[model samples]
Target chain A: MSSQPGTVRVPQEERTRAMRARLLEATVECLVERGFSGTSTTLVSERAGVSRGAQLHHFPTKNALVVAAVEHLTEVRGAELEKAAAALPTGRRRTRAVLQMLADHFTSPVFTAALELWVAARTDETLLAAVAPLEQRVGRQTHRLTVELLGADESRPGVRELVQATLDLVRGLGLANTITDDARRRRRILDQWAVALDDALADDDLQGETA
Target chain B: MSSQPGTVRVPQEERTRAMRARLLEATVECLVERGFSGTSTTLVSERAGVSRGAQLHHFPTKNALVVAAVEHLTEVRGAELEKAAAALPTGRRRTRAVLQMLADHFTSPVFTAALELWVAARTDETLLAAVAPLEQRVGRQTHRLTVELLGADESRPGVRELVQATLDLVRGLGLANTITDDARRRRRILDQWAVALDDALADDDLQGETA
Candidate 1:
């Protein structure tokens, strides 16, 4: 063991990785309870069952921990999206599956925690750097899904607007649903979304062909 | 002088009124900076430049402070809406004015702070009690506007859905415009709302109407 101590060790690397993971998990918990601005490094370290020194060793600053948590959230969300996408049969099934995924993920606790962190990160440079790419990923994925579902590119009349509209609808629904427990109202709102999706899908270039 | 003081002992109502106004104003400042959860009575009292004893004398509790703030916000918003409505020349103009008000208010810092408070209130009993009626007021106003704009009631074919859809559009646009600062994107989103409003105004009946 003394001989191996001079070399970089796998167990130490594994321990560091575990510590990082624990820190990320603790950040989510703290975020849920105290929100982004209210959460402190000491509180996070306490919640993670790690010493302040150990937490500092893993994440030297609050910003670093925030950036790491955002990255972790994106990875978790990406995995969930992929799993949802893979479970469905191809074509329209996938389209509906994606909508369903949007509905479910937008209201989930992890997404809510991430959203608050993102909003708070508006003034935090390190977190903002992490958020920009995740936003682009969302926009690109929306564009790609529109292309596949509409069977047309950007030139398709109202397709881009429709997709953007739907995206906004999802976000609004998420925000509103989070604050209200009126189940009937929530269902009615989502039902309207499903109805609009149906109407848009069934419409046959009513605006005429775009050049 | 002592006898005059007994004779001139003014009404307790005057002192309470002044204190309520100061407390409400201070609550708004606290909310804009610290959001809902981060806000504390001690912080609020400091911001108001009042003693903690004075704050408790006025509102008595944090929940009361939040409720008073909500009512103050509504009064302020109600006045703005009334001003906008008063400026409009006719029914269509009034509708357009109201839409603009919706866009302006939702994008404002006060409303954003109010929204955070609203979200935090979901599980908070005091907040829930304060917010429920305000939500009803929103629905009632929307219903009133629908009757005015659509020229019919919800029973008409596709009319209820159309009104719901248009409200949803405004809501969606508001949320999207919050996180992103792309003016062009904002313009495109608003244009869609304008189109939906125009369509609602133009169509007399869903079966025979032409856009």
Candidate 2:
């Protein structure tokens, strides 16, 4: 295919998809670097190497862009988690690995970006309206995935709460990391929590069998 | 309490002290309501019912004002915790109460203000310079207060980790509450953690004796 004309004749569908992906990724990068208020549509477009008009065409508003980026990142993480879960073997080790995976998710740029948006949404009504529902939906999906990943019998009395606690604990750990190097502290706590979790899970299964 | 023709003749030290308290209170209020970017020297002075000159005289800069507010709030919390701790009995019930107190501190306007400063400091160099050491100092003081509040045996193998986990867990819970009405979810996790803590504390003593 020789460049016979000014147009490269790329398919519009492919072009649009590529541009959208770039813009969303740029949004994530900006958010991870500059935070919510620091991120702007122009900045996102520039970072994406896309034209301003193209950025506007893809995302009409800042809220739309940031929200879409969050959704996109969540989807990507879901897929990664699915892949990770599929590759792992069953039992106690798997549970530990899954918890580590969950910890990684909490510590990732995905969480960092979400944190900025969450903080911004606290005061920005428009952003709150845009983010709250999307976040709720993503949060529910994450909880379900986490439950599946843990492979815990949620019907058990304490199992569900333990799983939820694990998520919340990791989330708190991640939040601590944002302010400073909480890695050492987080690891120490995680080690203790892991031991407690193993005991809890064992008790849950034993109770399940007896009941 | 004179409305005399001349100066009302309040002592300079007392007047300055009162004005400083007013400004800091206003700063926390604004941070809770409007967040960091929205809270300014002007807004703080106005809400504090103090004049601009008085505000500037007390806090030389916005960073100074905000950092002082954070330090002041932490001291206020420290005093509150000391009062509560002094009134409580030395036992498991006190442990639970301490956890609740920690939770309350995480959910207060002080935490909200700190959250704003933390997020802002992520990208703002001047703010980070002012905030990092102050935050470090507060974090150390908080950890000490927490250890005292829990009455944990720090020399024991796992007891210190458990206490640290408790702080991180509560901090995570507070962060969750910032995003949504996480009170219910937080209570559920807290109940589970409390049971675990009781067991852990008991185990630590047993292990301590065995070792």
Q: What is the DockQ of candidate 2?
A: 0.44
Candidate 2 colliding pairs, count: 0
Write out the backbone clash pairs for model 1: none
Question: Local error of candidate 2 at A193, Å?
Answer: 0.7
What tens-digit string does per-residue lDDT give for candidate 1 at A1-211? 7777746588788888888888898887777666676678999999888999989877888877866775686667767776766566665445545556666766676666766765655445567677667666765775575456435445655556656766666666676666665445544555445545545544454233443
For residues B1-211, could you state the per-residue lDDT of candidate 2 as single tens digits? Answer: 4666245554766788888988998998888888887888999999999989878877889999998998888889878877877776676567667777788889887888898889888878898898889888887787898887776778877677777778778877788788798877776667667666766676734322455
Against the native chain B, each candidate's TM-score is 0.76, 0.87
Q: In model 2, what is the error at residue B205, expressed in angstroms?
A: 10
Query: Best TM-score goes to which candidate?
Result: 2
For candidate 1, the docking band is acceptable
Q: Candidate 2 overall Cα lDDT vs. reference? A: 0.80
Error of 2 at B89 (Å): 5.4
Q: To one decimal place, how large is model 2's interface RMSD in Å? A: 2.6
